[model samples]
Target: MAGPLLDIEGLNVDFLTDQGWVTVVRDVSLSVAPGETVGLVGESGSGKTITSLSVMRLVPDPPGRITGGSIRFDGRDLLTLPERAMRQVRGNDIAMVFQESMTSLNPAFTIGDQIAEAVRHHLGLGRRAAVDRAVEVLDLVGIPAPRDRVDHYPHEFSGGMRQRAAIAMALACEPRLLIADEPTTALDVTVQAQVLELLRSLQQRLGMAMLFITHNLGVVADVCDRVSVMYAGQVVEVADVVDLFEAPAHPYTEGLLRSMPQLGVRGEPLATIPGNPPLPWAMPEGCRFHPRCPYATDACRSGAPALTERGGGHFSRCLRLAEIELTGAV
Candidate 1:
């Protein structure tokens, strides 16, 4: 089997706040094989978005920075690359569909123009060629009347259509990897499903690896081949979708799965983790999830457990992996 297309190792991101430099993303590592989809799932403050932003070298400076680790894509270390060289990587080799489509699209420019700008900037195509490429991608993403709608402003399009346009822009350059950060967060359930399906279809069609960042486990099960669960700036579990669902190793993973709304369980309250995620600067002494974990022990309060492999690419960051049996999504 071929090696991974995008490999991240020991990634640490820090922010300069009132409390000095606080690590917001700690020792994170994951990879995406060629033509594979990997889901990064976690609650809001789990650093999913920060991890994805670090890959593109898009973490804002002055406030945030990549303090440690390597981001390697296609055998190149992205962290060491010069800014100009990194620019070539962004939008050309890797494109990101951000959380909010409306904010992502420029209101002043037409949809076609925004896409064409990216195509022209990255691929160096002529204006006419870029416009044609924009039309082609819009049509490819299933937007109706592409040639005419291409001239429409962001306000002119509906929410779903705007989201599709953002995707079209991302796909215009035909990047090798796509980073989707909570792409369906703002849409209704139906539109979210449609967008998820569209993303699945596009990945299959383009044969591009994807890093899908979301808190939605149901969506992760539907679209992801592998899953990485993050909590309080660290990855707690990594497994194949089936393995993670059938036998969750980490307590946090189990909690997330159990908390999901299951079908045919009407009126039953959804399960939830006891406490909120800890703040980055004021992180706990030992395991970050210990305070909220149901099965935590005195040992869990003093020492952090390493993310250990349990054979067959399944891993968990729990000291009691062998001692406790956790329920899965199934």
Candidate 2:
């Protein structure tokens, strides 16, 4: 609804390994506008989390590093900011709700303490004001009796309640952008639906940008305004929610859509991509998904295609996107 809030270009992340510095995220680019939600969909080890971490300058330094890229948040280049300045921006201007809320919260602290601590640190609120703000935020996120539950420890809360608390903490600072990495991965169906709806409502109310990372396509369709399909370490396709589901532009996106059980014939096993993603250190020579692509040809096997727009904001990185007749066969 508003102007662009975050813009990332040519993001390259690498990890130092026995094989040398292996590229993890390659030339990755994405953007999120104010009050909009963008989904980054990919399987495990596809560098989705790494790409988000890089935006926050949270990449582990010794073994992992951001080799190149320009992360622009609110038109300011984050990569160029000094550590102290970046620390001030992180949490104050942008927040993240990482996967595995159980592990993300400190077992020793109360939900209120954690959330209030963020407000205290980032917004310079007094102890009482921070605690009051925490209660307000908890209630804002649909937490019942926030005043009573404020003293509950992480272990005392249910899985869904703890996740709500995690979101409450992330929103404590009223950040302009929220990066949620697989926040609903471990929830049950009911809770997952609740969380998704909660996210949509919160975004609408607060007018904050959200970059949601997940491997679930269903979630993307339900909550994302736009979606990007990531494979190996690069984005293969990006399109509006309706456009992507109607007709995915890349072979990998097609395979993923066909693999969903909802689209499969009754009583038949769900379709699946044939192979695991290539190791970042041992990536194939050309298109990363060529080995698994059903319509891969010589061009696909020998030369990777750069991302190109097809029209109406749809983009794909397949050399034969136009040439092949991909029918989404399971």
Candidate 3:
């Protein structure tokens, strides 16, 4: 409720490829207030993962780099911070739950040892204290028989359990800002629901701000306070969860919404966005989504449209948003 815990402006991340330096994230901006949950939604290759990595400063620099923009956390410029300072900030101030839990956890180390190692190294707690903290977090994350299971190896736990253990490790430092990138990927429906609920509960209890990067609109509807829709590395739309769902302003967002399986259209063919997402090396001239936009016009194929405010803090990046909004979701 105070100020933005994380403020990103004009963020540009580029990757050196065979073609040249290709921008994966282009002039992207976002923010997370204290204890607020903001969802970053996009299909794969839309640069969601890289954007999150940029914040954590985990983008492999030789291949990928933050070419432009500022990532400010708690009023400090993370881009300007030294490696040692950034290392201190990574686990302590900003923690990330990578896309998959299985590969992120070490098969050799027991779950307790991994979580305790973070606490021990970051919080400087003693071995005994770190282990206690690990047990406590495991219990907090709803892991059954935490005292015993905490010592189990990653492979020893079930898929859902391993995911829970991963979340427990991320929360071990009790970081102020938690970045979860597709945390529920490949999870069964029941387990996904449970994991999401646990995350919500833990965030509330700890009063932490969360930047949730996911492709699930249903999940976004359930948990996110605000939603940012990304397309071709740029944020196309941003609004409250209800606003974005009920009255999507950007065509890309509408296409995404229309693609969701609706109860009324149970047996019918599901709606899908036309055309493939633009490749980073061969990006379209104007709006990146224009190629797939059913409502695209001459203007859309020319100069790029700027992100414009659309009443009550809602924003959209489209050349003809007014007309498209009147026509409604595709």
For lDDT, candidate 1 versus 2, the one ahead is: 1
Candidate 3, residues 46-105, lDDT tens digits: the string is 999999999989999899989899999999999999999999998888998876677989
Q: For model 2, name the residue pairs that clash.
A: none
Please estimate how well model 2 matches the true structure, expressed as its whole-model Cα lDDT: 0.91
C-alpha root-mean-square deviation, each candidate? 0.7, 1.6, 1.4
Clash totals for all models, in order? Answer: 0, 0, 0
Candidate 2 wrongly placed segments (more than 4 Å): 1-3, 328-330
Task: Name model 1 segments beyond 4 Å from true.
Answer: none
- Candidates in order have lDDT scores of 0.95, 0.91, 0.91
Model 1, residue 168: distance off in Å is: 0.4
Q: For model 3, what is the alpha-carbon lDDT of residue 193?
A: 95
Q: Which pairs clash in model 1?
A: none
| Residue pairs with backbone overlap in model 3 | none
